[model samples]
Target: MPKGFQAMTPHAAPPISVEGLRRSFRGPDGRPFDAVAGLTFRIETPGTIVSLIGPDGAGKTTLLRLLAGILTPDAGEVRLFGRRPDTNDPEFVATLGFMPQRFGLYEELTVWENFKIFGALRGVEGAALETRFRDLMTLSGLKGFEEREAGKLSGGMKQKLGLSCALLSEPKLLLLDEPTVGVDPLSRRELWRILEAMRTRTGMTVLVSTAYLEEAARTDRTMLLSKGRLLAEDAPDALAQTTAGRGWRARALKDAEEARLARALMHDVRAASDSPAAAPWLDAVPHGEYVDLLTAADHTRSGTPPRLATDAPEAHLEPRAPTLEDAYCALTFPETRAVHAALAAPARRTDPPAPTRTAGNPLNAQDVQDAVVAEGISRRFGAFTAVADTSFRVRRGEIFGLLGPNGAGKTTTFRMLCGLLAPSGGRISVAGVDLRTARSAARAKVGYVAQKFSLYAQLSGRENLEYFGGCFGVSGRALRERIDELTAGGELARRLDARVGELPLGAKRELALACALIHRPEILFLDEATSGADVCARRAFWRRIVDLARAGTTVVVTTHFMEEAEYCDRFLIQDAGRVLALGTPLEVRRRAGAASVEEAFARIVTDARRRNAEGFAS
Candidate 1:
């Protein structure tokens, strides 16, 4: 048996296989939006995770649903272990496990109860059910609180329970739809651990859809779904190799200036808009944002978007490896607004440098102070000490990140930071406003995008903004102006009048961020706001966030991607509700002696866990 991500004995069979699949959804006006058109993929080896990556409304969910036998595609073929998937094969259905983006389980049931009921539904009972329950409980790290009601479980735990339930029958096929969206980084890793473990153990094939490009890159193979069609399908490495022969990075202007550069490069004789940038790239010459192909000597002018500069010492150059992210951008032909703007001529800044520090009273109308402050804060739930004395702060114009493992108290701490729950003890302020004096006022000074698409799905983007603006007391011209400002610019502006519910997952998230920033709050609290979005959308969303941060809006973001951690000015790692490490991302990783920020967080928590054990084990 594999015992890692998939466990399959010789008795095991191929878990899933699909052929020429097609699907569509009813548009807002009742037109058909072909989501998955003529898609084809196979799951031959058990325990291999295959991802369907694309923009939202790309039919990822539809494909998964079709495989789960929950929905029949308009035209296609699917088989689970050599049997047609949509047909009712009690044995196959019983053996297939699915975790939808919105998985449904009885909210009132205790974790154990839900597990048991699911087990029973699949006809596992008596000692077998008990044993399965015990194994799943441990595998999911769901011990010590089997009695915790489902309703009481955090988002991460609930999803874990859903997964455990899915694994209860030991299904030969597993399907997961963006299960780690709002889950903290630590939790996200733990979930992956379980995923890998299951794959290594069962040899059961797992097919999943994901918003994280890194996740897609890690999969054995991937399908790039675009507006109802299969854009590409191949190994991630092969996909990246398409542009691997020529790859380089060049420094461009920052923010609005960068936008200008991107726009200029977009129309410039070649190339178009790409997405997202943080930190600075090495200065290059010919002295434009793009790596002008004509500027490059070896360049064959094929349809391939030309590569930027590398090793041009006169260009103050630095060479780096091409990333899967870069490959995705290239293959997808992502818009290069950044490149375009980078190519534009520089504009001199006549004004002198502004003051480096600005502090205002928490009660003042001008929130010119630091974005967030925390000191010796702790949270406790009854006898359980969730978060211990944690302290960190974020200055204006910085992207501050918070990371931790699952069950590490990241969410608990977040709730406290958001004032959704009061800290058991601590001093905290947000956007120069003390959370205690007037929570609403403090909240008003900050923009927040929750992990879930909590916006009114039924409302059009315009109507939703109006209502949310009303909550902020913006009316008449002010409200309209604010709304216009939010939905302004590139892709999002085009969807202002579209129904929020009808928008793709990526568009909805973008709209949410725009809505949160409608009032131009001094700081933005993005609590895992990019989790279930499709790849292109996620990139576009991040581009917007970078724009916000560069515009001097203090941004505090929580995310599962380590690469994203690179964007932050600094970060704090939390585990079991305690701050374990704090510093610049590079510093923290160096201190932890780990290769990546995620690895550093794992190291810190491992150290903390060891300390806790030794301190208490007598």
Candidate 2:
């Protein structure tokens, strides 16, 4: 142990206990909005990991702030270790570590400087501080980057530094808010490993909030929240059991066949009110070669809807085990199946046109021509090489994904492609136009959505969209027409006049996407566009993306969610500024000998590390 550390006595009180907690805020309409309304729960175990899982605007952040004593509750009571916590009480506050979503680290300061400042603020000094610093450096993989400025680090490294700063004092209770939101899978796994090790060694209680439901499985217990209320709290397995018998998988022989069957199934569900046989099924979504279906567990007994046509000749339906995400969807959105089908209905009807092929001319072959191409792309900053000889091609109307671990040069390559960063070496082309000659013209043909929210926070959503539209040369009646069309049916319509800063994370994401499409460019570039969106919002966003692709819009996107890669036609995986693997999702999985895309990514990265280590030894 470092210093001022005390082990919890065997009979010590629980780390946290809450009773009738309630918090409300005034909405844009001047009406009271309950962020955390009448919530009641307790953390009885010590040294265990607990996760708060929910959609955007679900009150997870509010509850965390309340527990940290940063915000006083409007009503009810909260006890930390059987005592009320006071923000002004230094001794009380020192017992906990709170890392909000936006950690306050000076951008100009080096990593070591930030750590030292945080340590001093926590009143830790001398050997105790040094010892803690060394431990954190090793655990967070930040030892070699201590001299680097905080702003220069990649997204993943920045998060690691933030976490290291938070753990400097070794508090008994650690509170983290969405620590893995924009982080890649490899970094996310490493962070979890560090957290698990810390929990086991120090017996510290951890409470984290996350948007990814799959992450909840790693926690000792998961609490489900919605609209500022606790819907359920239980172990991962227990929650999965709630939707056990309702899960089913349907497989077809080919992609075309699968698509046809999926459409048929959806049609059956939508017309179920008239057709009793289809009424039993709740939802169906395409999963590669197969379609996953969800139905009421006791539909047969309920008799309100007849059983599905599982024996259909076009496809094969088999009962499948429920996953944590499946259970979460069932519990949180009971109408998820219908909602997904409704959102996807448009894309199913108008599929994108297939790439045309030339019969005789090899130069004009469909496979040889591409909308975007990069050959021998590289970028250097003084002595450091940020990108190295990266090459890839994106065909017209293809959903091409760029994936990599943090600091792997994804952003650098993305910037070069978008003309924001001039490459040190390479040739680039967009929309058959050479970027070297007509970069401005090429940029004009594409739309870009940045990784972080970039719109003016003070402006209303409508004003922001209108401004972006005008910047894209869309003015007069045309600009107004575009804005009205974009926000007509979605969440943006409801909050058109609300300030961008006041919107929820998901709503803000929607607004950014809408702004990017104001001019209807031929190509779209998105960098983690769905980072903070909820499951429903992500589904809706993808539906629109598919529609755009079908209408001849080429899409180049980067994402941390492994499952989202399924939507891509092809993807490129990079590491250490070099391409590690490039192929379709299934091809990459086969090369890595893995079961899923996530597993395949881990295998490829592990192999890359081994090769790099051998090169260093040689």
Sliding window of 10 residues with minimal summed lDDT for model 2: 343-352
Question: Taking the tens digit of each residue's C-alpha lDDT, what string does model 2 give over 70-147?
Answer: 889999999888878787776766778888786667779999899889887777888998898888989988888889
Worst 10 contiguous positions by lDDT, candidate 1 = 278-287
lDDT of 1 by residue, 384-404 (tens): 999888888787777788877
Q: How high is each candidate's TM-score?
A: 0.79, 0.87
Off by over 4 Å in 2: 1-12, 255-291, 296-314, 334-368, 473-481
TM-score of decoy 2: 0.87
* Candidate 2 Cα lDDT to native: 0.77
